[model samples]
Target: MAELISLDRFVDVLQAARREHIALIGGGGKTTLLHALGSQLGGSRVLTTTTVMGHDQHGDLPVVFPTTDGDVARAARNRAVIVWRRIEGKKAKGVAREDCDRWFDLVDHVVVEADGARQRPFKAPAPYEPVVPATATLLVSVIGADALGRVIADQCHRPLRVAALAGCTPYERLSATHAASVLLHHRGALRAKPAGARLVVVINKVDDTSRRSVDELVDVLHGRDRALQVIAISRR
Candidate 1:
């Protein structure tokens, strides 16, 4: 069995990881999780940005939007952040990958959302997906337990890619084994992950899944990557 963990404990892991520039990939609640981490980092100067993200998600938070170095240092100095570039139509543009590295000196921690999942609860990246910063010291790969037992074509982004990675048919119902296979694969969850970054996996929305199913997914993940950190979460 995997260790019992909670959302609060995961915050501690992120808090201790400020070598600690964090990037989020995979599916589930990436934006929700990233912003929540920025909010709960015990009042640290955390700057939240993204490689690619949608515009409506920010929801009027006091973000350092358009993220200039002087503006970011001023706004994020003693507040939780939601920094981004201008919103062109539906997308909230963010800084270039190397720029996050440049701003790392201004904040205690930097977190970026590095992929788009089209609102699906789960996904597998395409060739050009997940634009993680090379400077990130920690990577959080998330999967929604609610996706288990759902039809791949209906419930996942890049269903064909997910099918290819997990060896399941595109129209088939997803399973714990399939989720684990894709989540553990280098080209799946770790797509574009930075070298030397510590990995933490969050099986989100466990409230919608059975205990047995969630455990099965965690066990398969651990059986393959013994050192992998797997935690089950109901929400952000």
Candidate 2:
């Protein structure tokens, strides 16, 4: 297991250039971490975009691409690409994987949203699988403590809800009890690690009135995945 470090170390890793493709999953703190990292690395080594999955475009980072492309060979050559994990319009899905494998060298960091709220965590859409490539060194998944008791929905500003079509009974919009459920379910689903993938978990919305305490949350998260580093932050 990795030794725990100060929040500063977490921020350092988040800003470090060691990793190429980082995926922010879960809830609350995802956008916060992305924006913070994007701003710190902007104009220097980082670039950002969205797949129309959520309203992440409004965040601090500049959006380089508005759509998702599995084969971002041309775009990846000189700049990092932020991919929207989910596709919209239902007309044409995102890019293909073969193209990404062929042109994976073009990008330095391909930030992809690993999971959406519409589906369970860690599960990808049809015919689509996680593609950080061997070149990518970082793979992050985010979760929110505040999402515990609440059922994720398409609120126009939030990212895609994993439970949107998960077939689980919808709970109230956002409740303290429900927030707990969200945290447990999300953490449970994300405990497994991908091969050769370094995983990190960000527990978001710690500032929620019902979730000011971090000890239990941290314990629950660490218990789930000892190697999975967990950070608590507020997205609201």
Candidate 3:
């Protein structure tokens, strides 16, 4: 059986540096992972915005919308800070990648949720999607293990794009092979990845039912690209 690790341990496994910018992409557990990392790192971490996220997702963390560099510098001094441009209805609009880059030196860790999945278990990127920061030092691509065995059209965000990437019809059942293909494809989950950044693939919501599928996906991914590090976890 594969080992299950806590999100904090998973952050440790990534060997994230204080000065690094980490971008979370794909679906399922991106926001959960961002919050976990923020909590784990404690003070000096900045949860900056990118893509579209829920307006009230920050929990008790102090928020600075339409934030300035000075605001980030101040909030990041003793605690984790959530930075954004403003709130638009139910969504919190994030600052630009360029804006995030400007504060790379001010915070200990800048965690960016760089994609939106409409709360789906998995997703395939559309062209001009996944707004990753150019200065990102690590990119984590996530997918839910629950996505396996489900109909692609029903379980995934951008079902047509996922089908196109996996070379299957939308109504087809998702297989380990299909899941692996989507994650490793150049224009799939790895899209908009920054140059020279380390890449990590996270398979979340692993359990007895999804364990075999997650293992198969990991095996296939490693077999195809040894450089890719795959981690499976139950992110609850």
Candidate 4:
């Protein structure tokens, strides 16, 4: 199995934490964290299919629609999460508004993917994006070291905004300093995060030369505010 982060602290914090719903965001290791949590639970979870174009969950976990009928919802009571497909290929698929109304009552937990489809290291908003309710208990944002300055700008749907935020003329202006700033900026967005929901920062792709040591970044983040906790990993 892939090296797993000991989630005991997280489990303790969230088992009775305020928020009931949790959404994973950002880029690096989002799926890895999801699978790690799901696998740790070692039980059935309703893995809902999503519209985000990428690899599929190869497991046999039972999946049900957010629009599933009452009977279907009841049938999926044994599921761990309802993998809601919000956007398909950068377009909104369904918002899970009605789906949440019907099924949220049945499941013990609902793990939503708060995916921002821009595909760049720097986050950007999209049209008809899935706006998950603020009730999400956790928001996990992933950041890959490799994406810090390259693919995010080169392949992003929009590079201008990213460059502007990074205060660079171009995406190429991104550097370790830029990466640290972006991480901190995104982390700041969670300042008003609800008491129940936990915001986790996952620094991934440590295998990449650009993001090898997080000490500088960690020091910077904590230097600003020592309350934050960050976990670093490489899913290469």
- lDDT score for residue 204 of model 3: 85
Give the worst 10-residue stretch by lDDT in candidate 4.
Answer: 1-10
Question: How do these models rank on lDDT, best leading?
Answer: 3, 1, 4, 2
Which of 2 and 4 is ahead in lDDT? 4
Q: Per-residue CA lDDT of candidate 1, range 131-211, in tens?
A: 888888888888877788889999999999999999989899889899988887878977777788888888887763456
| lDDT (tens digit, per residue) of candidate 3 on 1-236 | 45666666877776676567889999878888888788777448889668878888986788886446877878788678788888899988888988888787777788999888999989998898889989899899999888998999999999999999999999998998998899989999777888889899988888888888888887788889987888788755
Every model: Cα RMSD to truth:
2.2, 7.1, 1.4, 5.1
lDDT for model 1 comes to 0.77
Best by TM-score: 3
lDDT of each: 0.77, 0.43, 0.84, 0.49
Clash pairs of candidate 1? 17-20
On TM-score, the stronger of 2 and 3 is 3
Top lDDT prediction, candidate number: 3
Candidate closer to the true structure by TM-score (higher is better), 3 or 4: 3
Summarize candidate 4's per-residue lDDT along 86-140 as a digit string, tens digits.
Answer: 4455433434534543444555554555565444444533334334445555656
Clashes of each: 1, 24, 0, 14
| lDDT of model 2 at position 83 | 39
Please give the ranking of all candidate structures by TM-score, highest first, separated by commas: 3, 1, 4, 2
Per-residue lDDT, model 1, residue 109, is: 77
TM-score of 1: 0.90
